[model samples]
Target: MENNFAENISPAFSSIYEEYETLSKENYCDIYRRNTIRKHVETYLNPKDTILEINAGSGIDAVYFAKAGYNVLATDIADSAGIYIKNKIKTEGLKNLEFQKCSFTDLSSIENKKFNHIFSNYGGLNCTNNLEEIFSQFNDLLHPKGFVSLVIMPKFYPWEMATFLKGNKNAFRRWKKNGVLANVNNHLIPTFYHSPKQIKRAMGNDFKAVSIKNIGTFYPSLHYNSLHKHPKTINFLMHLDSWINGKSIIPKGIGDYFIITFQKNT
Candidate 1:
């Protein structure tokens, strides 16, 4: 087995990850947030291309892509994630989606398969220390002109720093090179924060940056559970984001999460 830079994942914890994440899930306005990301992701994806989704939590995004008429192979380190997608596949009779229990760094099981796109969402790769190792593999896995879209946390997000006002000392946790341990379901998981520059270098010279858009920026955070209650405010932010998102509108290092896309240099 290769060294898993995502130091804390294990079979025992895998079964409970979804449950552990419920607390955050309940606090997050996911529907609105997901639609926002999906809108951006689909713009870069070709419906005919097979997508390999890493860190596929609950296989939600995979199912979404499949339903939209794309072929998808959803892979996750957690075995439970496989179960969720399998159940969804069976229930929906989805023919275009496949599931596998796999880790991002160790995708040897599917080495023979090549894809036109790669995706990972919700900062799942943040658990690993080896950003370069992961990105380097994309060149081999993707065809020429292939795209990779990742929604991951950057080394800095302005809103999180506001935690200092709430008297939280670990406001700048992402700044730590060694990473910090996040408590989930009484389990401490190691989480790392990466910057766009670091990811670009890790992607080597084979990949070119396509676009970087702010995932959660300004006014209300994605984690703000009650966003639905304030539809007007959220709408304004969405409207504002539309203008500044993909056109290099939002400044780097300012979003709670960022959707960074890269394309293989043909």
Candidate 2:
């Protein structure tokens, strides 16, 4: 990652890093994101694999993976999140986890070992405009035949677009632009949404596209906070989402986020 990019964006992430855990607890959507990733990851993961988690905000997923027997090096741009993860590791006596303060594009800073899995959950990679350049780092950091699972926001989501009916055109149309300014903890954070095809192009031929599954397909986008009040409806949506995500009949790249997995070609 460029020094200027990190310098400009660090403050925006830092502003929200402290309250991140609290927000995660309050947000049912976040729980959905984590549950979706964990369920998908279990299908392919082995205990011997090592993981490099990018944008590991609060390291929730990292800790979960570590607990499941994979050693995880969780990296985040925010120093506060890194400190919090470190303290959690200490409190829990979790030796399989490591914390690093770094951006997703800056994995080169770590020099010791190559990882078998790289994970970026819930739109972490969407913060940058340089998908092609940033993805080039993956081949170097991961071992041959290694896998990467990315849960990313794409350029289009039907659920989000449904907001237009409610007179929130701005929210509905945010992804129409190449870049949009998001208010994160009162700070303006620039976010860019990428298509599944764009991510595949960025990864290039060295990596084979394994699968792409919809996450927010039948379920409404997380922005509809009011829907959380209906437990029965939310439960039904969760079951529906699970059933529809991996079905090829469902269109790809239309959900709030999609999970795309790839394996480095040996």
Candidate 3:
């Protein structure tokens, strides 16, 4: 991880970045989500392919993929990430993993880098509305027939609606047009929800859809983290989640988040 790579990082989201692992680290729902997302990516691309990962928070996924035999360049806007990422590299002795403090919108720092696979997880791209500007850069970075996998929130989620019924006021925040202000540790960060269609359209003719899979559909939200205490209930929910985890009859863009994969096309 480079020391001076991240520049102009906002003070608002900076604390959220530093406290991210603390927030989700104990959430079992998040643990399941990460493993499921990794399985989908592994199924889509080979370990031999190098990956350029944007918004690589805490570098957990980067380290996981690197240990699984993939070379990964993990980029994040959080300078605080350097400390955690560096510690992981030193302790894990990871040679295939590299870290850069880069934002997806401005790839100029890594513009010369080419990769067979690009990954951004957990709605990091939702922070900005300039996706067209972002996807245009993908044309230059991805090899022909290479893959891009993103995990993004949709306009609507059934489970979120269920949470709404239970009095979670922010449940329907995705409906906001200009985007919603995500209250992270009392700091407001703007977030936008995007559908799979919107993402593919922005990706343009240079990419073709490969798969759309449910992530956390039928699985209880981490907000319901207490459900983890009940083994029988957890087993039943996990079974339903497994049934809907991969490609299914369920339409796209209807999960807590969906992992959509696209391949670069000539």
What RMSD, rounded to one decimal, does every model reach?
3.2, 2.2, 4.0
Report lDDT per candidate: 0.77, 0.80, 0.78
Q: Residues 137-181, candidate 1, lDDT per residue (tens digit)?
A: 788788889999988888777667887898979889989888888
Candidate rank order under lDDT: 2, 3, 1
Q: After superposition, which runs of candidate 1 have C-alpha atoms over 4 Å from their true positions?
A: 1-28, 222-231
Candidate achieving higher TM-score, 1 or 3: 3
Worst lDDT window (10 residues) for model 2?
1-10
For candidate 2, lDDT tens digit of each residue in 1-266? Answer: 23334665666776666565765677676677678778887776787689999988888788888888888999998767777789889988889999988877678997887999989988888878788777888898898889999988887777777777888767555466657766776666667788888899988988999888888877776557789778689879877877876567777887788899999998
Better of 2 and 3 by TM-score: 2
Checking candidate 3 for backbone clashes, the offending pairs are none
| lDDT (Cα, tens digit) per residue for candidate 3, span 138-173 | 878887788999989888787777777789998788
- Candidate that would win on TM-score: 2
Worst 10 residues of 3 by lDDT: 1-10
TM-score of 3: 0.89
